[model samples]
Target: MTSYPMHTVDTAPAEARTPLTVLRETFGFVPGAAAVMANSPVLLNTFFSAFGHFRGGTFTPAERQVLLLSNAVANASEWAVAFHTLEALADGVAPEVVDAVRRGARPGDPRMAALSGLTVAFIEKRGHLGEADVKAFTAAGFGEGQLFEVVAGVAISAMANYTANVAGPPLEPAVEPHAWTAGTGAGA
Candidate 1:
């Protein structure tokens, strides 16, 4: 396995320190996955900016979690899944909804199911979403603009998911209860 440095604001490069601090302040701590990415200031900055954009977009907190959790699951990223699962639950997404996404199934709610399905297809298709996919997504009552919103969410989720998979960032204790493996049925 390739080892990546897990950075703290004090130890991170000048450019990375600010973002790491922002992450720590906003999230109450810097996520390990973000810290690992801090090895490259550019990568860390890009991740932070894209994540900020997604957070500032139109999706509700629950919708954002669905996309991110689905992305983590699609990438088979244990660490990202755990982080997202905790955030999703805290955001008041139903436990069943998070569970279904962890299990690679859609949420019971039709609208959520559509969002999850769109995220899966978007990831699996590698952003070459077709008209049919768009039609189905829109049929779920999301607007065409939200499709673009999904794109932004996917970008952030993909970065986090791939980073966690590649670096195996340690799960924070707060999220340990939700720690997950790719196929082990959520967490222990």
Candidate 2:
């Protein structure tokens, strides 16, 4: 397998430096996946742009975490799974809900379940959702617009997840405790 550098702000390419710096300042450190993504300024910036839009979208922090975690599990990205696991817990998603998402099972909370279900379906089906998929998401109180927002979340996660899969960055310390193995999850 090919290896990629885990770049720091000082070591990243010129265009990637600014975003790495901002990420470091915001998170107190650059995440492992982002570090690897710094290999390409375009990839890093694109991920950051989509991430910014997703954060500004309609989902609550917990709901966003649910969708992100679902995407991670569905993509079978170990680094993403661990990162999203910690973020999900920190964002106040219930432990059981996080676990359920990690296991690729429906979450216990109605709203989270709906979010996770649609997100997993979105990924597993490659955006070719059935009518019931759309209805289930709407019935959970999410609007059609929010369904599109989930698309944004899935897209954002896809970039990160695919990056991690390809680069195989080491897990950051903060997320290490929540580390995952690809086939360990029930979904695998």
Candidate 3:
């Protein structure tokens, strides 16, 4: 069977919408991705909006691109890694930077390298972090606030990553070309 139910928008089943409505409306059709997330659309919406906020406010356009795309690559999320990495490149991050992030490397930023390293550790350790990890991050110039931002980044991507895996949402029109290959280490 097809991964997602394919029907005319008007023909889809009625699903509950708790704030994912804005997203459903934004897309003009509710794919299984959103419908499944409707169980806790607030979680998904919060994740999406938070990512938007961070993209706009916390990190520089280039830095945000690096943190995000690299994280997605680390998680091996093909869909997210593809889109954000491209968005990063389109937003003026160097091709070399994009290339680095796509390969799940540190993109040559000490701060991002520290953050990404912590992120990989936290994920691999399932959140059991060492004092040295936090200290190393701070020593590298990431403050408590940066740590918070990193957590937010991880949370938001965790939502998208899980949703994408479960719903297997077809890549959005804007991101199809950047789609990830299965078992790739981009999101690992």
Candidate number with greatest TM-score:
2
lDDT ranking, high to low: 2, 1, 3
Which segments of model 2 are wrong by more than 4 Å? Answer: 186-188
Candidate 2: clashing pairs of residues: none
Q: Supply candidate 3's per-residue lDDT for 90.
A: 73
lDDT of 2: 0.89
**Clashes in model 3: which pairs?**
73-186, 73-187, 74-187, 74-188, 75-187, 75-188, 76-186, 76-187, 76-188, 77-187
> Which lDDT tens digits does candidate 3 get at residues 74-151?
677666676676578777877766766676566576776776677766666777889988887888876777777777
Give per-candidate clash totals.
0, 0, 10
List the candidates' TM-scores in order.
Answer: 0.95, 0.96, 0.70
For every candidate in turn, the CA RMSD to the true structure comes to 1.5, 2.0, 4.3
Question: lDDT per prediction?
Answer: 0.88, 0.89, 0.64
Candidate whose lDDT is highest: 2
> What CA RMSD would candidate 1 show?
1.5
